[model samples]
Structures are given as structure tokens and as C-alpha cells.
Target: MIDYTSPIQTTFELQRRSLEQSQQALEQSVDIGQQISESLLAGLDSQEQFQRRLVELNRDTVASALDAIESLPGADVAVDDLRENIDDGYERLLDGHEEAFDNISAELEDGTDSYDDLTAELLETVEEQLDLLVEAHEELEAQSVEAVDELAGQVEELQDQAEDVQAQIEQVSEDAARAVEA
Candidate 1:
């Protein structure tokens, strides 16, 4: 009739809530980390665009300046060489940006997967341990109930024995009265 395992049940409920909160926090943190990564990549992308535009502007300015001095010997070859070098620099910058993005993205993905896996395992372990505690508590309660039943049976048997002795005493008293009358 009494819920002896109420405390354990309450503890389990509280632990479950705490675990759920932990899981939620982990998820939120992962999302925030991902957002940060995306922001960083976007910033880098914007910078790359800006740098490419700057290189283009420089190339055009140099070309226009050379055109103004086209009467000079080798002016055209000098303009072409300057443009090629600027183009090469831009290409290298682009490659570096791509490499950095790939590295960061890969690392973030791997880290996320590891964190998720660790969280799942931790939660599962806690649940399993909690279940075992409940199971053990239930067994203990069952044993207590059995012991109480056994004790009650013993007390009832003692009472029955006492009543039998009382009946014998009365019979003996009557026999003595009859003997005294004779």
C-alpha cells in the first residue's frame, strides 16, 4: 500500500529532467558553434571579394597609366606583365581561402559528431544505472513485504497457542472442583 520507492522515483524524475536539459544545452551550443563558423566563413568570403576587387582596380589603373605612356618603348609588355602578376596573386589568395574554409568546416563537422556521440553515450549510461537502482530498490521492497508477512503469520500462531493454553487451564480448574466436592 505504501510507496517505499517514492524517493527513488522522484530522484529518477529529477535526474531525467537534468539530463534532458544537458542534452538541450549541448544542442544549442552546437548550433551556436555552427553559426559562428558560418559567420567566420562569410566574413572571409567578403574579404576575398574585396581583395579581388582591389586587385582589379589596381590592374585597370596601371593599364590606363601605361596607355597614356604608350609612346614609350615596351609600355605594352610592362602592362601585360603587371596584370599577369596581379592575376596570379588573386588566384593564390582564392586558393588559400578555399583551403582554410575546407579545413575549418571539416574540423567543425568532426567535432560535432564526436560531441553528439559522447552526449548520447553519457545519457544512455545514466539511464541504465538509474534503472538498475530502481530494480534493486524494488527487490528490496519485495523482500521487506515477504518478511512482514512471515512475521504476521508467526504472531498469529503464537496467539492461537495462548488461547489453547487458556482453555486447558479452565478444564483443569473444573476437574479440581469436582474432586473437592467428592
Candidate 2:
């Protein structure tokens, strides 16, 4: 008996793992953002630290963003590959089921006495394979949806952070202008 479920199961597992990794990456990004904000606020007491921290923050932020952008293509490729694997699995499952049914029908037409036993066994196998495929598909779909939602939330958060940073920079500029005028 050919085990058709293993490949699908492995694909789902790989996708789930990838999702987990992405979530971890997002968390790390958030952590870095928080650290940058904290560093900016903390150095306000000292001119040297304030200037140094700002430089460091800019460098870190740019580096982090570049790292993220670079990783995106690989992530996209993984997702595309996963989708292709899923499509292939579905096609193979359907083809196998169809072939099994055709074979059983042909045997029945020939008035084979063993057709009943063969059909029953084939039906059971098909049902099991179908169930596995459906379950895997549902799991993969749910995971993908959840990952997308989380990523959207992360993007929104990063946007908010950017806005906050911009506001801070503007305030600093205004303060410097006032001091210069005085």
C-alpha cells in the first residue's frame, strides 16, 4: 500500500514550522523597535549620549530593515513552494482515487467474484486518504490565514512606531531651533 499521507503531512509540518519562525522574527523586530525607543528616551539627560544613541538607533534601524527586506524574498519563495506542494498533493490524491475507481469498475464489468472485497478495501483506503488530505488542507489554510493576520498587525505596529519616531524627531528639531534663536 502506497503511503500518500506522509508527503502532505510533511509539507504541513514544514509550513507550520516556517510560520513559527516568522512569528519569532516579528517578535524580535518588535523587541528591537522597543529597545530603540527606550534608548532614545533614556539618553535625553546627556547631550553626548543623546547624540550617540540617535546615531546608533538610526544605524540599527536601517540594518534591521535591510535584514528584514532581504529575508522577505526567501520567505515568499517558501510560501510559493508550499502552495505548489499542496496543489500537487491534491492532484495526486484525486488521480489516485480516480484510477482506483476505474480499476474497480473494470473488474466489476468482467464479473470478477473478488470485486466486492477489492472495492470495499479500495473504498476504505480512498476514504482514509481523502480524510487525511482534507484535514491537512484545512490546517494549512488556517495557519496561512493566521500568519497573514499577524503579519498585517506587525506592519501596522511598525508604521505606528515610525510615526512616533517622526514626531520625536520633529520635536527635537523645534527645540534646537528655539535654542538657536535664543
Candidate 3:
């Protein structure tokens, strides 16, 4: 006799394997996203550090120039002019530094926001897929139970029919024996 449950069992196994693969892929995607975010933050931190070092170097150079100007003999007017120029340069440098800092701050904030949005979207997609898988599994389970119940009923009917056929065969054998004796 053919095993009727084999096909159903194979189908369920295939679906289970597919679901496992999908879950693994989702996990990998989340890991990759986290790595990318970490890399971006690290790069931003390095850039900020470089900018600070550059500002410090520029300040030291300005101070050194002012000391050199002060040491020169018979150059009072030149010293005054040099001081004014240094003041103006320092002011401009500070303003530029502030502007660059603001721009970087805004860019970093925007990057963080974008990362958060992407993460939220990915999570939502994963949740939806999981829900669908769960629904499919529940439906399959219900169908399997219904099929088994139907098969059981058919088996019971076949057993009753076999018993009736056996009774008829016994009656015929008894009649033949009586005829022979007569």
C-alpha cells in the first residue's frame, strides 16, 4: 500500500528549511547594518580629532610669530601692525573653526537619523515576514489534522465492509454442506 502521508511530510520539511534560511539571512543583514554604523561613527570621530589638531597647530604658529616680531630692535610701528594682523588672523581662524564644527555636527546628526530610519524599516520588514511564516505553519497544521481524521473514518468503514463479506462467505459454505448430506 502507498504511504499517503509521505508527500505531506516532505512538503512540511521543505517549508521548514526555507523558513530557517530566511531567518539566517535576516540575522546576517542586521549584523551588517550594525557594522556599517560603527564604521561611520569611527570615521567621524577621526575627522573631528584631525580638525582639533590642526587648530592647535595654527594657534602655536601665530604665537611664535608674535614672539619673533617683539624681539626685533627699532621696530615699534612694525610690531604694532604685526600684532593687529595677528589678532585679525586669529579671529578669522576661530570663526572658521566654529563654522566647520557646526557643519560637522549637523552632518553627524543627519547620518545618525538616517541610520535609525534604516534600522526601523529593516525591523518592520522582518516582523512582517515572521508573521506570514507563523500563519502558514498554523494553516498547514490544521490541514494535516483534518486529512488524518478523514483517513481514519475511511479505514473504519472498510473494516465494517470486510466483516460483512466474511459472514456471507460462512453462510454459503454451510448451505453447500447441507445439500451434500441430503
Candidate 4:
């Protein structure tokens, strides 16, 4: 009456589902790695734009400084002021680029660390599932042993009943022979 197939099916489904989930997690990790790599390589900062802006500013300052100096030879204060402003702007531009590079580097490092952590967590989860599977297998083996023991007991009982029936037949034959003789 016990449909033993049910437990086998249940175990099989559990294993199947666990494997599926593990596979999905692996794929997701791979995707995350790819995205991170792309993001790192894509140059996600305004450093290049800032450099271009600095170049334009320097060109404009040089043109204006030259014009001011050429216009008045006696006194040219605008040229010196323009040069100083241009130098300051260039220094600030360099500093901004350095800061941008540092920021981007830090972001990439953080992303890499996070990816590693995610992968490690996924692997740990899979390991835990495998451990559970091993425990389930051991439990099934124990149940099988119990079932075999029960079957053996039933077989032994059947054998004893067969022997008792054979003895009763032999005794009935002996009684019939005695009756015929009487």
C-alpha cells in the first residue's frame, strides 16, 4: 500500500531544483563580472573633457596676453595677469584629473571586491546544498536498511509457517494409516 515511488520522486525533485538554482547563481555571477569589466574599461569619468576645457582656456589666455602686450609697449599689466591666471587654471586642471583618476580607481577596487564576495557567497551556498544532499542520501540509505530488515523478518516468518504446515500434513497421514489398520 505504500507508494514508495513518492519519496524517490521527492528526493529527485529536490536535487534537480538545487542544481538549477546553483546554475542560475553561477550565470548571474558571470554576468556581473562581465558588466564590471565593461564598466571599468569604458572610462566613466570627465577627465578627458576637463583636459580639453583646460586647453581651450590656455589658448584663449595666450591670445589675449599677446594682444595686450603688442598693443602697449610702455605698460602691459594685462599680459602678466593673464599668464598667472592661465598657470593657476592649468594647475587646477591637473589636480582635478588626478582626483578623478583616484576616485575611479577606488570605485573599481570596490567593485572588484564586491564581485569576489558575491562569488564566494555563491560557492558557499552550493557547498551547503551539497552537504544537505549528502545527508539526505545517508538518510535514504538508513531507511533502505530498515526496509530490508523488515523484509527479512517477514521472510523468516513465512518459512516457519511452511515448516509447521508440512509437519501437520505428515501427522495427518500417520493418523489415516492407523485408522485403516484398525
In order, the Cα lDDT scores of the candidates are: 0.69, 0.62, 0.77, 0.72
Worst 10 residues of 4 by lDDT: 1-10
Measured with C-alpha atoms, the lDDT of residue 86 in candidate 3 is 78
Find the 10 residues in a row with the least total lDDT in model 1: 1-10
Number of backbone clashes in candidate 1: 0
- Considering only N, C-alpha and C atoms within 3 Å, which residue pairs clash in candidate 2? none
Model 2, stretches more than 4 Å misplaced?
Answer: 1-111
All models, RMSD in angstroms: 7.6, 42.4, 4.8, 7.0
lDDT of 3 at 174: 90
**Model number with the top TM-score:** 3
RMSD of 4: 7.0
**lDDT by residue (tens digit), candidate 2, 31-134:** 56556544543443354445446655665665565556557856656555655665566557556655665565555444433543565565566556656766
Q: Tell me which of candidates 2 and 3 scores higher on lDDT.
A: 3
lDDT of 3: 0.77
User: Candidate 4 has which clashing residue pairs, if any?
Assistant: none
Pairs that clash in candidate 3: none
Q: By lDDT, highest first, what's the ranking?
A: 3, 4, 1, 2
* lDDT for 120 (candidate 1): 64
Encode model 3's per-residue lDDT on 1-182: one tens digit a residue: 34566777677778877887887787777778778777776777687678767876887787777678778786667878877887788779878876887787678768867877887787788778877986888688668957976797788788778888888888888998898999
Clashing pairs in 1: none
Clash numbers, per candidate: 0, 0, 0, 0
Compared with the true structure, the alpha-carbon lDDT of candidate 4 equals 0.72
How many steric overlaps does candidate 3 have?
Answer: 0
